[model samples]
Target: MVSNQNSKNLYQALWSSADILRSKMDANEYKNYLLGIVFYKYLSDRMLVFAVDLLEESASDLEEAQVIFTKAMDDGEVKDDLLYALKDEFSYLIEPSLTFTALVHDVYRGKFQLEDLAQGFRNIEQSNELFENLFEDVDLYSKKLGATPQKQNQTIANVMKELADLDLAHQGDILGDAYEYLISQFASESGKKAGEFYTPQPISELMTRIAIDGKEDQKGFSVYDPTMGSGSLLLNVRRFSNEKGFINYFGQELNTSTFNLARMNMILHGVDSANQHLRNGDTLDGDWPTEEPTNFDAVLMNPPYSAKWSGEKGFLDDPRFSMYGVLAPKSKADFAFLLHGYYHLKESGVMAIILPHGVLFRGNSEGKIREILLRNGAIDTVIGLPANIFFSTSIPTTVIILKKNRPNQDVLFIDASNGFTKGKNQNVLEPNHIEAIIDTYQKRVSIEKYAHLATFDEIKENDFNLNIPRYVDTFEEEEPIHLGELAQEIAATNDSLAQAEKELATLFGELVSTSPEIEKELAQFRQLLHGGGLE
Candidate 1:
């Protein structure tokens, strides 16, 4: 089981290594270097563990086992057999000279070279089709590292030594959690670009739970995220299942760097490379899942909001959009992504997508799309999330949950916009808030002032607009006041004021008898106080 202590260790280890690279470049640029080294160390450590296990049959301890394995690797036949077996299982192999431990040892001995690290990346990528171009983003010789080769080598050596001290092998989910921590840290620093590849953890958890609500015990359960984004959201689905290894993961990322991040995340989490099918391309422009009428059991995504698309006339014939008759407008592809995911949802599947509020009320092509989805009962529930929960934008977003083959047309609306714990940088959905959403969704019951179950006629009465406020009344009523009581209080205040004024006038008369000039000034003040002109 994953624990908070493991997460803390991973965060600290990655942050400590990040400190060495912080002064050299921004988070956006330094992340590639930092994540690349950590992934390399994970692969190298995995190889060491495999070799140590194999050597334990003949040797007494790990140190003595390494001596025997080194002698075995020097032999041609034995090396070929080991490489074939390791490559078949892991889909990649690390050489003794280029392994992470070897590089760390060189760093301590003051003899490490940047070229050896670069070659190690090349060798791993060349070993199998799965790892091709995986290290393209990690440019060891980039000027961001240093202006000179010698300086670049020194900088990389420091990172290697810092990462060498971390024990990534024992703790569950340490490497995966560390990679996620680094990605999140970089995303927070990357500003608007963060939305392209990362989704906040709380939102990911909520979506995953919603998607996997009733599919906890099924065998061979599959989950997909069309807009995978570092694969954190997709990986989150596995946690809800009783059998983790029974789940197969599928995802596509538009960004190459983030695509690699997803792949690294999958492998570090103990997912076999064969179980994950990740591709890099525009999710809207092409038809994926082309492997013979494939539909997933659960689909979860937080796609980019209102991104522009071609919306060409040719897409009218595409099965994903053809049924709508009018494509989603080119200015807003929110529904376009929805239709794409909906097209791949199984008859018994559930899909949850995070989108802007405009998707709920926008007219024309988007409205037509909403109408068809509502009539067909594809939209199961609409959840309004708090504003500023995302690092990229503060726009209040909604999670639209869809299900196919439904017998009823009722849609559940949850007003979670007011359900969050405020934070310094961004609002957060606490555990209670998340559970409230799930409980209400699963029970299909309405909570006072928080949720409402609307029938098809109620939605159509509002002209097919599925806005939450129209269905759920979150309007807070103020306490009522009694006009008669207020008037009596005002009258009592006036009487008290009049009595105080008379007492003040008596005190001024005493001062008038003492001095003539003072009495003249006091008379003017008394006249002004009694509503007479000061002049």
Candidate 2:
């Protein structure tokens, strides 16, 4: 029952102290020390609760024995069995002195080696296989943290001691928020490398809702993002709640570090690992989890735009590409990722992915893939998003929603590029813009200036190019040139020029723009030059 203010306060207490490490070391290096110890503290707190509950259960069972001949209650003799059970339960205890704070405190007092603390972390991780390799060896005491073991220990001590003093209760999403803050801060500082993985939260939220389509009660659901960097897409699905709902998430990432980050992110957000298959492998190689081919409910992906992949090695037999007849080029894997998403999609599931505009009308294998999908009525919706929504890549991307089972044989195309607000660095899709796109998806109805529903034959006639402008007719024809109207417009322009010149002359003569302060100074100058005489 933590209030939002309380959560904010807790975050401020911990994250505000991260500036201490900003000057001493790289933020990415300091992340391990900060997050690793916080995770340790969380583990210890939960374990304490577990042990206390287990002991209480044991004590209740033992007290039922016919040994009620010990301490006297107010009315009569009471059973002593409860006392003995409590003592036995204390044996399975983690000493309070060994808590995360205690270790940090000892480091400040110069009484402990960092190796002991590192071993303590390993032991805590070993305490539960449920969290095996939860952090991918954060190495809080490794040289990566500092210049040497002692220096690393000192840095860790300072960071932990600062964080340990914070009041982060194990109640809600405080940890997740803190972790997200760290990631965002890293994104701001690390530039391209960090930007490659993390999509801004607002953008991610919009993408997830568009893909989920107001379904709230749907469980056993599966969603995915092939380039699931830090799992912003997967986590945002949990934020989706409508009259109908979605249940689970699934994703695969090629970068081992980013893969670990996604898994850690899911865990911090309280998503059960069983419900998410965040495998660490290249998705292009079909290195995805191959157990169940088409059991997913919805698949959403923002695969790296135009990234090179192994797409030319007889990929026609890769199962994902075999039916498409040709693999995408080695340089542009956009169609390849889309085919993989389409391959794993259930018969009724929807696949919405962000791709560069080139993928819509690219000739060759991509065009072939487009023809195959559209011919099968897999193309359901095509949404054009504003440019620069994704980090690292500022190219405007499109969302192609493919449905295996379509109730209609038409495609919905929405042109939203001109519908976004301009920001300082990039264009942004506000909440209303996202809502408008989702509304178009649900309605499948065409609008006058925004969306269009093109028939399958129309797409075929257009050579199967799914570009937004192909279906959505946003062309504004210029008014027919009128000779009389042009002559009148030219006369008006000449009149305006004459009026502007006259206004400028009179305004300069009066000089009314200068105030009384300047007028007083001018009077002094006139007195000095004209000997105080009126003209």
Give the top-scoring candidate (lDDT): 1
Q: 145-212, model 1: which lDDT tens digit per residue?
A: 88999989988998887777665655557667667767887989887888988999999999999888
Q: Compared with the true structure, what per-residue lDDT tens digits does model 2 show for residues 201-312?
A: 6667666776666465666667767778888777777777542133566778887667767776776676654576667788887547577744566787878889898776
For residue 164, model 2's alpha carbon misses the true position, in angstroms, by: 1.2
Considering every candidate listed, which one attains the maximal TM-score? 1
- Candidate 2 Cα lDDT to native: 0.68
| TM-score, prediction 2 | 0.78
Model 1 TM-score (2 dp): 0.88
